[model samples]
Target: MAFASGSRADRPNIVLVVADDQGWGDVGYQGHPVLKTPHLDEAARSGLRFERFYAQAPVCSPTRATLLTGRHPNRMGVFTWGYPIRPQEITLAKLLREAGYATGHFGKWHLGSVYRASPVHPGRMGFERWVSSPNFFDNNPIFSDEGTAVPFQGESSVVTVQVALEWIRKQAEAGRPFFAMICFGSPHAPHQAAEEDRALYLDQPPALREFYGEITGIDRAFGMLRQALAELGIRENTILWYTSDNGALPKVGSTGGFRGNKGQIYEGGLLVPTFLEWPAKIRTPRVTRVRCCSADIFPTILEIVGIEPPANLPLDGISLVPVIEGKWERRPVPLGFWHYPAPGISTPSAKWMAELLAAQQKGEDLPPDGPSQRAGQLPDPPYPSDQFPGHAAWIEGDWKLHRIETAKGKIRWELYNLEEDPAESTDRAAEEPERLGAMQKRLEAWLRSVVQSLNGADYAGLGESPSLPESKSR
Candidate 1:
């Protein structure tokens, strides 16, 4: 095992819960007028709440990719939704499993097709056990049970949590340290909630009833999971982390008065609610305005386990351990975001994925790349920086710089003082020349580093090349 074995107390259990498309104002603690997120609100009050936490990307797949690898999504070619993470990139599950931790993933697994034999399937991606759906699913959805379609009962969020709780209980009974990631599909699309949950929003507008109810269901499920930890007598030592994948979804979603919505590089699109509860480590519950991103999660885990990351891999995020211990205040490094203007490759439908799994179970000959193999097929090597096009940004303290390339091939620069104008209402590109120049230089340099990783530079001496022939085409 990679992690040096130690006392049971030295290896803390970790639970990471992610909500799909939930926003900063989705929880009642953030002062949302209609949404009832009691469980999340309680979490914020009893934990270290992050006032300025950000998702690495403004989309699901990209932020998720970063959460596992500690590198920017674009580096691994996960540009947008409907894309699979390149198999070469390291994942948190794999890391934890190697460290003698029981790891399981439950709920939505949008990183790749859940079909059997797919190289990027949750199991192949390092998850020891996974009960997952191909993408966002509604109530009573059919899940890929370790690559076989199985019907599940009850609300989407509730079912996901129940599945995760079952695995957690077994690990707890075995006295084994474990890592569980519960990715809820509720409040994503086709916003569907149970009839009882929808009844709570009867006074809400008919159009928003389902959406609000979905959030409530998520809150209920979250509350159940937390309560389970307490009942299992494993609440204090376990680190429970909660956050959304990205920002709000425009009108129906609330961004807490920031500018832009999902898919945009604006503050509203990237910033999301975040909280970390480790009763054994953090005794005081307080909120901090220090800027942090999803990329930091992987490094933070390594720090908690007292393990060093592989030297060859480059991480874009720093550990938040100091912050948790109240030894750090300001973030030493600025956060960078680049939404490469690239369309994500589409995977096969759920039906086709199920059919492929059945063929595998019957000993049928299938393609080596498995089902959904046609989604991504990379070209020959020599991938250069110029080929990676995108609108990039760099956030240093309060200052933010945006670089946009128009369809006409014209470059435009815009700067914003986020501390003064959190909404990004004013552009200070012309007013602040020196600051703009410095930020632009930093942004470009960061992009160059990311490009090198995209070209398989980071994996050079790691024994495995980063090239993904049937993936990473993003």
Candidate 2:
């Protein structure tokens, strides 16, 4: 049967649940023997599981920025972790809000400060309500409740889902459509799990035991969320998207035999497990091999709600609605990724940002990174350079091209047919000379466009004043 096709009210409610560092093979459905993820496994079996989905970038903040804005993270100068997104850039929440959908955010919000006064906080980003952490947190986290830090009980994922469900229930009771972004901080570093969850992996090594337990905790929490949706009777018309922000961590996470781990531009770093469940639209369960990215979320949601982006805006993502309906087989537009060379800001822990938010409420004066003010800064290059001085890649169909910058300031190019080399072991650059040359030109042009955006081209005529913070590179 065809998916629902009707008025705007028939449109599905969208929920995006992102994991911090869950790997491509971390779930039970992906053949992980140690980790217990029955809820995610069931979702994969009952939905459209993306076999070749990728995160826009191989990190937390940048990928999250892409998920909301449907633009490359670098466009708004969010090149690394803890970098803030530009306030002027349009966000998915704002777009959906204008379309008459209520929006809320829960869990880890590493994109910027959770403090209410920050220009790029979740509230300013279009989420009407939010309970977010500045970064990753463990059990019993202190969350910024719409800009005020408050203590929450329970494991991280469980706490996040509970708050989200509360907001969702409120919307459903009021007969209003809603969008909820649930970002989990599980399976990241400093793995912490409830005693019961950890007990499931006690036989394993100490480190692996804790890591697997955290994932199990996330699985249980997700199952609770799915149940809530069904009981609320919104499951039939809700679009639920689940995936990680990036690839796996070293030693603890699995990349499913792909090359490289987190922080690289390789398949392992970029590729992540993704599943979408829309009971009203996707009547049958299936797996799709089409390449998709986190950036595609914005356009996909827009297509579902029959909303068009502002004219003259350049979106890096194309709508995947056709792909979902099984009409479009191949990706129409090439995807680009660049890891700009820089180190992300390192805080002592989640408490640092929580304290900052608390300080802001007191109306005290503090430095940008201190308790009173918690704004992150983006880079302002001396001049827009012609050189693409970083590791970058462009994927078109099964062909993947890579440009790596060496420490000695040298550039190297590598090409691979991903269909024949999922591991990216063989460099076909020598044999496919003409094809490689064409891809290089396309990549260079794409990089040039991104540079233009970094310099504030997309915000033309938005009338919002720009906030250019002081630049600091590590």
Candidate 3:
């Protein structure tokens, strides 16, 4: 598609909203028995709902990285939750800002440090304004406003949306196109919900009341945001996309009957509830089961705004423009997911932000070498070029193949026809040898490519320090 450099009115405003640790079966539209997500349900009904949407990873930060860069997180060395996005990678926000759009980010910014001096801070990543937290936060949170800690009161989701809407309204009044990433830190662990929201689920267990209450708060906050858009008269042209960072939490969250939860690479872990509303482009409501992932977000937005992605940038995600326009029923490219065994880096939002706030109040500063700035520090390549540890999966059409690397160095492969077995309860590897072999070969090749990217082959002249392996790929 040609780059869209049309008038300001011709370009659609974009709002990407993400929920933290929200499960596939958490919303009312998805047949959740208890949770009431009236706002999200209406949005799903009125727009394009995705039946098989997925987070690129089964955790937080990696999936967020994929959403921002249109590449697998592993490609940029963001292997798990709490990992920071590589500063060398091109971000969607930076591209949009360069294309004459005002860009801002609110709420959880788990991809990297929110400190002003951090190389991977939101400002460095192209957002002009940011009220972000280093990790998930609950009510009455402290956020970094371009690196200065600012305390805010109220429910976390409500405060996040209100702040974003304030910036959005200004851009709308000025008649400039804007892109806002509103990420909500809700229903994660230590579930804390506003009392009123918690009251809605009185009949449920105490733990569930808190869990469901946070979702209810998110639902109400989402409603407030959507209502504001309509009230501002920018609802028609704005593309409002809603999805979760990962899958459901264990015990407290629901996955709509998929196998595993959260950390696993099963359907419950990767699959997420997703919907997009763009009234100007999608006049009619529809639902699509064509497979898509968080990585698709960056490319899809770029195609919509008519921005050409940087040449030679390897994107694991394909433009979903065709899917949005109702032109394509199937994804042309298969989605690949990997769970590298690297441990998650620690980034406690409440603790870190409090320290930042105290330091600022006392006219002091935290150490530059703190864990918050670890995202900018590249690690040495410890694994061999051919050694891909942990679990990986390849998805093509209705077939899914799993490549498991046991800790003892044993490798196992499992294949399942997801169409017939959503839970992956029965492995079809033994039943369908021919299909299994083809998928296995394709998956191995893809893993090698990811390893090459991880080793910094893609940053040839990008000025990034490449952690090149001693030997080339076998």
Candidate 4:
């Protein structure tokens, strides 16, 4: 029981609802052509809608790492698809637990290899009770609860809501200030829905038919989630944060008017919908246009709880508490982003990623080194880390610079002033050489700093003060 027992005056339960592969246009507020999300829309209507909010990465594990650790996924060792979040990193759950919030992770836990001995398993990663899956589970899929894989009935979204509801109820009964993360793997892939959710979109266009069904199912589950919170009399006090893992994935929902699908560094890949609903705190539904990211979640929670990080390990995210309270206009600091090392497995999951994760990390102390320690493993050559051309981007005011390494010239860079080109349709790199070069230098310097921390070069210094991208006066 790592969760400390704090005084009642110092605690508030946190419920972070993450929808997998859910797009900006999938919600009712965002105006999907046919999707029905009455509950989520109401959450948006009654809470603060964060426009220009982004997932830390273009994928789930990376984004989750950001939300939990208040830093880039690379800094925590979750670089790409199927990479496990290294155990040494700090997570929101761990922080909240230290601050006396009982933490539980319900739904998908994709930050690690789901195997029983993975170091980064949910239980080992600071969660008190974790009912999770290795990754996105199709309908009626198996879930690893703490250690055992159990079959769950009903749709994926519905089951996720139910598990979370049960956990919250238990925590409430125990009089504990709980921090539960419901990482719903809905709308991710293998888009399937119950007949009820399916019928709503059956008459729509071929492209939206199945996709809408998936979102609807997720919506219904969201409704149930809200109802459960209200029924428990905790809806008003709980901080309910809703957002997605990444932007709209390909062959699925719309990314609103943004260009490029998931996997690209465009706004579509990074920018997803976001909102914070706390009826007691955010009584009015205010639309905030400030830019924020998944990394902010952890630090904000710590700030709200008044648990100042040790003098050594400062946080990367600024507290949005003042913003939520309508006390500020713009973030006083700059935001950072790096889609680094590239899109490949960056961890030690050699060959057992599939079966091992399903079993969950059962043993105590769960072995530290996963696939990496296995000889003849370590993944083959052309690792995304080595071959994948990565782009380190920085958005200051209206400008975003992406220094890419394409054959177009080894040191290619593209600049997009989002104020003028929200869709990022045109590449003005060659046109504005001077401005591009300046921004590229800034981006490169930031990349170097990120790489230093990501490779564990500055863990000791991190506790003293989290690294920041060198400030540039745009």
Candidate 5:
């Protein structure tokens, strides 16, 4: 099904489909027993499948920040989930629109809802027409369509795709070249799926069955998305990307035998499923073993769409357009990982998270809030730059280092040669002190650079929440 021939000069439409909480092996090609991802499977067979792509962070907002800016999330001040994208950043839709493309984003937009009474919504973020939710939602959800929160019925996954389909059809009829981002929130938390979707995998255990059912529900809609594109004659030229926000939620599906699940700096936590389909440009069906991260996406898309990147802006990710075009050149830049010094609760921590969720389900509810959703500039941190310390990591070549700081002590260190051991099973700090020492110095240097970036050394404090035409936050 791969497109036999074509070129970027043809100005193909683009569709970036992102799945929330989907694991590494939660599909047919990855060898999951219950999950059935026919559309994604066929897309993989029809295009380039990246076997070792990673999210920019182990959590959501940070990785998404990377997606929009082509820079490390931490560098842009998105150190955790639900953080704002620093309104000053450059986005793909905005850049692509410079080329006469009609840009839109439909589905989950966990970036920032309303900040500083500003109109920095999707349209301000470079998207022309946006029907988005602040974050993940269940069936019969209420979401913001451009500004108004509207109610929609159906399973969350199906509803997510259905909304995007409607938008795509409109764009097609207008003969506009489009770039759409479809964010699906499924198999995350309080698992919900339609009875028919659940029945599709009723043979499995309760948890596994529910997990698989949610995935299958999304899979069917993904197939429909492809079909709709083909019927519109846009499938062949579109560079359709399919990937997850992060890794699995554990037990639901394997993180492909990597160390940790989601919400950790470990390979398993950050690694995710990634594939690119373009019937026009991609010739042979292929698989990439090279490591790629979410930050690289921005630069790659800009290059593909012929936008000249700012030379003054330092980007941690190189353009991946060459790699996607069957070229063989590895990215030479450093890949950064910062889990922040703050200890936030992430999922799959035994029954602790489950218990919190269960209690809320029982109606003893705790209101959810985060910094990004809070209106205005808000307050800055009380601690100095040095006080924060959960964990920080840096990956250069095949070497990886993890730094752990105690409440009142010098930070401890651990190192691993990922080339020799990808799973990071053994800490070679004690065994090979010199290699460890060298990596520690490099990691520190990278950290200093990160600190500089965070302080706005790059853009000089230019990006901030724009004043919205109307305050959506009440």
Candidate 6:
């Protein structure tokens, strides 16, 4: 793979903005009757809007891992929320930094410990600077500033944007291409919106009022970010991509009529609202129905910036350069999603940071061998390659095949033609036995490849990681 243009000057500034727990129907352009997202609506009208964008997994940490690595989370053992990204994997931030891009990460960094010594902290993961939280945070949150706990005032979303803008502005002044990952910690559980934002949604139930308000706050912060970009004169060449980490919350979130919610292997849990704006490249507004996933973001960005990925690393995502250029009508490969049966590590950002802040203030240092610091430790290898347990889905074009393993170890298969039934209300497995059989075989093969990777296949001798088969999808 040759570099896209061969000049660093040709690379555009990239900003990946992710929302926590936001759903497909949460934005105004997506037909949300209540949420007022004027800025997002405008971006959709003026840029490339994706009708079928998916998160690699139905949870936050896994999806975030895919966005950063372009590889399936399972390949690195990030099976659920709060799991740290394996240190052996190369991240987009690390690659971009190596390519002379100023990289910064702001807001939630649930992939690993935020402490300075943690092997998987943003600083060690290639972020030149970061003000990050270990998990979802609330207003007046305390964040880890390169391992030092610092309390920030005002709304969490506002604080995140402000911190990121400060760094972005400096990069603009220095005339350097920058990649900023702004992950907002709002609209998640225990939604706590700013007072003024909450007032706009008083008509809704109390809980929903806060949830809607949090979304509104995100909208305001996003508007501020866009305005800042224009003021800096970098808006035209900046590729501003926006999407959520996962599906909606169970009660207070909307799935846009899709079946299932967060943490499930259904349309509602996977599908997300996504769009990109880069006036220098995307001069005309376009809407693409072609299916895409968060994993594609890594390769697409690498292609756009003319950076070559590491040769030995296998990517579950393919570059979407053709789609962005309006030359692609369909995806070239199937998308695989698996929810391995593993309990999530509890990583409460506010509580942990508060404790750190208190400890620092008291002149006490916490031990380095704490659970947070040891998050990246690998489990014993030799995982069962024969038995693939959990809910897994394989999507090719409009057809989706689900391979589910019941607690009793029975395997059940269901097929859905998503184009005809986006809700997944009807099963087509019995009616289309041949198609089901073929998809099942492919899905199972992919699952085995994932298992192989989990058993240290992909790593070769990098660590104790397993190897993946050569025929595995990249």
lDDT of 2 at 170: 87
Report the lDDT tens digits of candidate 4 across residue range 1-474. Answer: 011224664366888989988767668788776678888888898899998887888777788877887877766556766667655566677666766677888888777654455556677677878877877776776776665556788888899888878778887877778888998777876677777888887777765666677788888888898888888888877888999999897867688988867777788888887898887768778998777888788777877776765343335577787778777666666566766545465432222333444435453223434442231122233133232246657777777777666634375667787879999878888898888777766666666555555555545554522222221111
lDDT of 2 by residue, 132-164 (tens): 887888988888776666788898899999988
Task: Show model 6 residue runs off by greater than 4 Å.
Answer: 1-3, 368-372, 461-474
Q: Residue pairs in steric clash, candidate 5?
A: 88-463, 117-468, 118-467, 118-468, 119-467, 119-468, 341-389, 341-390
Q: Rank the candidates by lDDT, best first.
A: 3, 6, 2, 1, 5, 4
Name the runs in model 4 displaced over 4 angstroms: 1-6, 205-207, 310-316, 341-369, 372-389, 407-409, 428-435, 461-474
Off by over 4 Å in 5: 1-9, 114-120, 343-370, 373-388, 461-474
State in Å the error of residue 109, model 4.
0.9
TM-score of each: 0.92, 0.93, 0.95, 0.86, 0.86, 0.95
Give the per-residue lDDT of model 5 (tens digit) for 374-409. Answer: 423422542244543667777777778888767684
Cα lDDT of model 6 by residue, 1-474, tens digit: 232666767678999999999989889998888888888889889999998999999999999999999989998899999888887778898888878788899999999888767878887777888889999899999998878899999988999999999989998998888999999998888989999999999899999889999998998999999999999999998999999999877888889999998999798998888999999889999999999999999999988887887666778899988998888899989999999889998988877898889999998745432554655555685777767789999999899999899767899988999989999989999999889888888888888888777666666655532222112000
Residue clash pairs of candidate 6: 455-466, 456-465, 456-466, 456-467, 457-466, 457-467, 458-466, 458-467
- Cα lDDT of all candidates, in order? 0.82, 0.83, 0.87, 0.71, 0.72, 0.87
Candidate 4 TM-score, true structure as reference: 0.86
**lDDT (Cα, tens digit) per residue for candidate 3, span 39-121:** 99999999999999999999999999888889889888898877778777888988888787888899998987787678677
Better of 3 and 4 by TM-score: 3
Error of 2 at 105 (Å): 0.6
Residue-wise C-alpha lDDT for candidate 1, range 107-224, written one tens digit per residue: 8777777766677877777778788887788888777777666777799999999988988999888888998989999688778879988999999887689999999999999999
User: Which is superior by TM-score, 1 or 3?
Assistant: 3
